[model samples]
Target: MQHPAVPELAHTHTRPIHWVATATAIAGVVALSSLLQPKPATAAQSATPDAKPAPTTAPSTADVDFPLDCGPEQALVVKKATGDLDGDGTPETVAVVHCDAPMGTPPDGVYVLTHNPGHTHARVVATLIDPKARNTVTGLTVTDGAVLATLLGYSTADVPSCCPDVKDSARWQWKDNTFVRSTPAGARSI
Candidate 1:
């Protein structure tokens, strides 16, 4: 009997070809990962060549208790301000505390903590969480019973936390036993 129009060689081996291609791609990815992996430091490189000698005298801030109070579990610490925030004569505290630091989007914000002489605990009076804008409070000034917080806002939302181009110096006052924004310094015009 006469053979059909095409030869056996004309038929393509589809399944094996696909399998080969997939295997090759997987092998290439594995090889690339090995090349990109960070190398561990050797014992020879442990000694820093440019390291300075140990200080002969004690540090100037040895007696100072900076970053005061609370243990590692303390989520909030007074980073910038500490004064009579509520005009209660006792020194109040102001700090940068982002409640969403470990969970949602970054919102490292300014907070005001009022000290209580009756107890060891302090209460939060004001919480200014600028999520879509500022990185952190650069400086805080309590002037004439008003708190002025200088915040560094980002140039773009996609930018990192450390690099902020815009400056929002907002003013807040403790009036009627509450923290009120005296001057609104919201996000800059994008």
Candidate 2:
């Protein structure tokens, strides 16, 4: 039955073309939306007059003279890890260094290096393991504001330099404006 008030609407009938057109328009909208995505949100706050920007780069091990007296040989950084060890915004580098020796195993010194915001060179802030300890750092890492290391040492002076008889695990954490050393576990004979 046709009503006099409104003629039969042609668009009211479902057609294949109408479906195709509607689907294409929806696809175009989705594609456009993907390309117009908003920038990712960051927790970083905008720079203020008194606020100092956090350091982006960690301290470098190269060129920084360590406290170890290598004498004629050069100091070599064997392993290094970087992290925010002092709860400061800036990161520090934990380096396992030893003298470049051509022969027997050389003792390693673990040092913490920090670079000042505007400084070009990094300076050694703390010495975790002194070379005089006659220990070799087998593994070094900085995690959760703590410096961890596996050290190999001689049981006595009679122990040959080529071989270490004792194995020890060490951890250092920043506390009270100083790095405090703690033996996490008991040393074992290797």
Give the runs in model 2 whose Cα sits over 4 Å from its true position: 1-52
* Cα distance off (Å), candidate 2, residue 101: 1.2
- The per-model lDDT (C-alpha) reads 0.58, 0.88
Please provide, for model 1 over 19-111, each residue's C-alpha lDDT reduced to its tens digit, 9 standing for 90 to 100.
899899999999999899887877754548875443332122111222323244334433555666665555666666543344333445566
User: Best candidate per lDDT, number?
Assistant: 2
Which 10 residues in a row give candidate 1 its minimum summed lDDT?
57-66
For 1-190, candidate 2 gives per-residue lDDT tens digits of 5667987799999999999999999999999999999989899776799876676789888789899888899999999999999997789999999999988888999989998556778999899999999999888888899998988999899988888889989889999999998986555557
Clashing pairs in 2: none
What is the TM-score (0 to 1) of candidate 1?
0.45
Instruction: Name the TM-score of candidate 2.
Output: 0.70
The segments of candidate 1 whose C-alpha lies over 4 angstroms from its true place after superposition are 1-78, 98-107, 130-134, 160-162, 184-190
lDDT score, candidate 1, position 75: 45
Task: For model 2, give the 10-residue run with minimal summed lDDT.
Answer: 181-190
